[model samples]
Target: MRKRALDTVFALAQQDERVVYIGSDVGQGTLQGFQESIPERFFVEAISEAYVIGMAAGMAMTGFVPYVNTIATFLTRRCLDQIAVDLCIGNHPVRLVANGGGLVYAPLGPTHEAIEDIALMRCLPNMTVLVPCDAEEMERAVRASLDWSGPIYIRIARGGESVVSLPERGFFIGKAIEVRQGEKLLIATTGVMLQTALEVQDIMARAGYNLGIVHFHTVKPLDTAWLANQLGPYSHVASLEEHSVIGGLGSALAEWLCENGDHKLKRFGIPDRFADRFGNQAKLLSYFGLDAASIAKELQAWVKPS
Candidate 1:
């Protein structure tokens, strides 16, 4: 997904002269093609994340769409003030292409995890938080991001994710995708959780419970209209994400559902604590009860399997 996103930035630059690439300590080979092809527009800076946001803001003001690439934690945690002041305040068209979102760097410990990044990016007034489900969706988001107004935060997941999204459903910045429809339960997921939701859906199916899925790639502009309509038939609704339970897709749904509906939402995500263990992404996911088996077990506690 990271490759697809960065490669798409170069593809966009090829078509639009206004597009520029900015990398922050992402190694020399990062976006190498873009740097070689458009050396004048490519910039590889040091570990100055705040400076990157300010630079992108300035470039945006000059009518250039600057796409900044870096780790998710640094992009949000280290540069929140700059992002809010320089990008969100001015409503620049700078694209924050964040890599290793939501624990992709779990082997590196909590410091590398972007568990709270969604909340940080979502709080900004003009910042649009987008978490694509896979590489294809990431590519689509990149292309769709070319014209969207305001600062956009594109969350990139680990590579080699499942392909649950389809071109037929189409890609829109604010619209959610309906992966499947069910009668008993509806599982709303964002980013890499779509595939896990699908696995859980099938798990519940074997136990005689029907489950539906709504892929919420866009978290900021919650697709309330479509989501509101989709929840009517299901007896249960839930949100599954790879981010922290707070201030992410789960919290966003709670804020909207609390006022508008009576459905009790079951949120499945990382708890409100920092990660202390070290392992691969899959190990961390299993340890956090985000794997399909564990998620299904939790779901069964609420709704009887059979």
Candidate 2:
């Protein structure tokens, strides 16, 4: 997914002179073709994340659309002040290509994980938060960022995610796509959790429960109109994400339900705690009861009557 997004940025740079690529000490030979093609517009700086954001802000001030790539934890935790002051304050057209969102860096421990990135980015004013499900959707998200008016924080998982998003459904920023249609239960998801939600949908279907899954690719400027319309038809609604249960897609939906309507909502995500153990992404998800089997079991308990 990361490679696909950067490749899309490179493709866009070929056509648009305003496109610039900046990386904060990423792996060697990353986007080598882009650097060779557009030497003047490509930069691979040291581990100075704050300085890199400031540079991107300056480039944006000069009417250049800069795409900054770095670890998600560094982008959100290390450069909060620069992002808040330089990007959000002025609403710059800087695209933050954050890698290792959620527990993608689980083997590297909590220091590298970005479990709270969504909460951090979504709270900033004028910041658009996106979490594409797979490589194909990441391409669409990258393409959409080219014309976006303000700063965009796109959270992507490691490569090799399943393609749950269909081309026929189309891609639109701030629009929710309903992948499955059913009554009584609504499973709203963001990021790679859509894949788990789809699996849970099938599991519930086999067990005689109809489940609907909605992919919320854009979280900040949420598709409230579509959500509002969809919320009215379902008796139980659940939100799933790889992020913390607070201030993420689930929290956003909870807030909207609080104001606009009344519905039963169960938010499935990382609880309010740090993942101190060292393991891969699958282990962390399983530990947090976010795996497809665990999610299906929880949903069965929630949807079934006492």
Candidate 3:
């Protein structure tokens, strides 16, 4: 997914002279094609994440669209001031391609984990938060970011996630895609959690429960119209994300529900506590009760037989 998004940025650079690629302490051969093709526009800097963000903001002011790539934690947590003051304040069109979102770096421990990235990015003004489910969706998000008006934060997962998004339904920024249609219950999700939601949907189906699924790739500037419309018919609405329960997709839904409707909502995400254990991504997800089986079990408890 990360490679595909970077490739899209390279392709966009080929077509647009205003496009630039900046990396902060990345691997030696990272975006090598972009460097070789457009040496003047490519920048590889050291461990200075704040400096990189300030530089990207300055380039945006100069009418250049800069795509900054780095670890998710460094981009969101390390450069919060620069992101808030430089990018969000002015509404720059800088594309932040964040790698290792959620628990993708679980083996590297909590410092490397980006569990709060969504919440952090969503709180900033003029920041568009996106969590693509797979490489295909990542390509679409990257392509769309080229024309998007403000600072865009694209949260990328570890590669080889299942492709749950269909091309036929099409991809649109700030639009929710309904992957499955049913009644009584709605399962709204973002990022790679869509895959787990789909699995849970199938499990519930086999057990005689119909689960509807909505995929929200674009978190901020959320598809409220779709959510508001779809949520009305269901008796229960649940939000699933690979992020914290606070200030993420689930929280966003909760906030919306308070203003719009009186629907019952169950949020499934990491608790508001640091994951102090070291393990693979899959293990950590299961440990946090985000695996498909655990999600299905939770759903079975929430939506009882009529």
Model 2, range 1-306, lDDT digits (tens) per residue?
999999999999999999999999999999999999899999999999999999999999999999999999999999999999999999999999999999999889888999999999999999999999999999999998999999999987978988878878778999999988888899999999999998888888888887888999999899999977776558889999999999899999999988987789999999999998887998999999999999989989888721
Query: Deviation in angstroms for 182 in model 1?
Result: 0.2
Clash totals for all candidate models: 0, 0, 0
For residue 68, model 1's alpha carbon misses the true position, in angstroms, by 0.3
> lDDT (CA) for every model shown?
0.91, 0.92, 0.92
Q: Model 1 — which ten-residue stretch has the worst lDDT?
A: 297-306
Give me the overall lDDT of model 1: 0.91
Model 1 scores a TM of: 0.98
**What is the C-alpha lDDT profile of model 1 across 1-306, one tens digit per residue?**
999999999999999999999999897698887887899999988889999899999999999999999999999999999999999888999999998999899999998899999999999999999999999999999999999989999999999998888999889989999999887678999999999999998889988887889999999888998877778777678899999999999999999888988887999999999998998999998999999999998888887543
As for lDDT, the candidate ahead, 1 or 2, is 2
TM-score for each predicted model, relative to the true structure: 0.98, 0.98, 0.98
Kindly list the per-residue Cα lDDT of model 3 for residues 1-306, writing each as its tens digit.
999999999999999999999999988898899999899999999999999999999999999999999999999999999999999999999999999999999999999999999999999999999999999999988988898989999999999998877878777889999988888889999999999998988889889988889999999989999976777568888999999999999999999988987889999999999997888999999999999999989889888843
